[model samples]
Target chain A: MMSNLLLLSLAVLAAAILGCLYRLLKGPTVPDRIAALDTIGVLLLSMIAVLCMLFRTTAYLDIILVIGILTFIGTTALTRYIERGVIIEDGDAEDDR
Target chain B: MIGEMAIGAVVLLGACIGAISAFGLIRLPDIYLRSHAATKSATVGVLLILAAAFLYFLLYLDHVSVKLLLGIVFVFLTAPVAGHLTGRAAYRSGVSLWKGSVRDDLKQEDSSAQGPL
Candidate 1:
């Protein structure tokens, strides 16, 4: 049986995801959108965890882990690009000119 | 018997905290402030819920559930870093701090051409 408490936690998490989406859509700055994107990553991990518990399967965990690693790298690369306009090592910032 | 009750209580508590964090994310006037609330509150809430799930799995299942705990650990390790990176990125990308924001200390560093201080 799915516990009432897990149900409530999932509900609350859903609401948080919605709030993040609002920020993503409405944010006026690039980094603001990225902040929301970071939240989405965490939220995705939690949602996967809750889903695992509900379904009693660890199968989705691999997906969660993959998503986590990928999102972390993606966000870091995007941050570097946004901050300096380049994801490469050179300080030339290919797009800065 | 008591285990079920404890699990329920923990889950409910986690949910309430998560909701509060969401509210903070929505109501906070700036990205940095919202990141503070969203990151810490959600991390704590998820950890609590993960703990309850760990206990539940231990009590009810005979299969290996250590992996679930590992997932929780991964979450704990990554969430803060992601939030920090995003917040720093926001700060660097010129997102304005709220009007009532008191700290202009970094402005001094910027005045010297320190690349946003």
Candidate 2:
């Protein structure tokens, strides 16, 4: 039963990845594409958790946590860049080149 | 036997809901509408699957798995935050709502206003 459920969840996650791919390709604006990327991150984390249970391993949880944090930071940085035209300081990029 | 059946039902239900969410994501007309379906449904689906995992470990295997529970809790807290931030960021960047969208709350914010008269 557990195995069956694990398989079902994986299939759904795959479908989500496909949906996200469509959005990433068709997104009308930069932010829309960013949202799709964020969705992909969440779906990936969920998939990892489900797979961890099926395989009886706790090791994957660490990867999920790290990926979740990194994805959040990356999305936030992208958002900052889109909204303000800059995220990090080159210091002199604000002046020339 | 009962535990096994319960796990199966929960897993299948989660999968169904997840599939529905993906369908909604594709079929919805605009980014905001698709987001509404994606965030809520996907979160629920993940919660359901995590609950199944919790039950499987606790009941069938007779093991108390702290990591599984922690993962579930982390997902519950972060999913909404991530979705909300993504939506707000999209709005802030001028991704227009669908043509017929009504009563946009974000538009009322002063900083969202455009150039001088």
Candidate 3:
């Protein structure tokens, strides 16, 4: 029964991932795409958590942490790029101020 | 048996919420509204699923999954920040809001300030 529930949840998460993928592909603007990407990341995180339960192991927890850190950095960097048209500001250029 | 049932129900509920969030992501007309759906519902859905996992291990196996706990905390911390950054970027980059939106409070405030936003 537990496995059955896990499988069902996995199916639903997969469907959700597909839906986000559609948004990612069809998004009319760059920020729209970024938002879709962020959503997909979160969905994947939940999916992995469910998979861990199904497998009856804690080994996959590290994957979850890695995904979390990567998603945050990716989203933040993309956002900064969109706002400024550049991700990295030059430190030496600001020394005159 | 009862605990197992509870866990199943919780996981199912979380999955359903996640599906709903995805539906909103696709259906919403603008990036801002899409961010709303993606951030709030998805965050809560994942959190609930993580809670279910925590409960299951704690009750059935008599062990606390620190990783699941970490995941819950991580999601809670990051999701909103991502949404905010995306929305701010969109607005700053001049992505127009949906026509049906009632106000432009940010624009109005920026215009009145006579300074860079």
Interface RMSD of each: 2.8, 3.7, 2.1
lDDT of 3 by residue, A14-90 (tens): 99999999999999999999988998888898898888888887788789888988888999999988888777789
Is model 1 an incorrect, acceptable, medium or high docking prediction?
medium
lDDT of 1 by residue, A48-95 (tens): 767777777667767767776777788889888887776877555344
Docking quality (DockQ) of candidate 2: 0.39
The candidate that achieves the highest TM-score relative to the unseen native structure: 3
Put down candidate 2 lDDT per residue, B3-117, tens digits, no spaces: 6777767877876777777777777877777778767887787788777777777876677777767767776787677667667667766777888887866566534565211
Q: If the candidates were sorted by their DockQ against the true structure, best first, what order would they fall in?
A: 3, 1, 2
TM-score of chain B of each: 0.90, 0.88, 0.91
CAPRI level of candidate 2: acceptable
Clashing residue pairs, candidate 3? none
Candidate 3: tens digits of C-alpha lDDT, residues B1-117: 877877988998898899899999999999999999999999999999989988877887787888778878999999999999999999888899999999887887767774454
How high is each candidate's TM-score? 0.85, 0.81, 0.93
lDDT of 2 by residue, A27-97 (tens): 77776677777767767777776787778766676776676677778787887777667788676667321
For candidate 1, write residues B1-117 as lDDT tens digits.
Answer: 667777767876776677677777778888888888877987887788777767777776655576667767877887788788878777777788999998777667776766533
Please identify which of the two predictions, 2 or 3, would achieve the higher lDDT against the true structure.
Answer: 3
Residue A63 accuracy (lDDT) in model 2: 73
Among all candidates shown, the one with the greatest lDDT = 3
**Which segments of candidate 3 are over 4 A away from where they belong?**
A91-97, B112-117
lDDT of each: 0.75, 0.73, 0.88
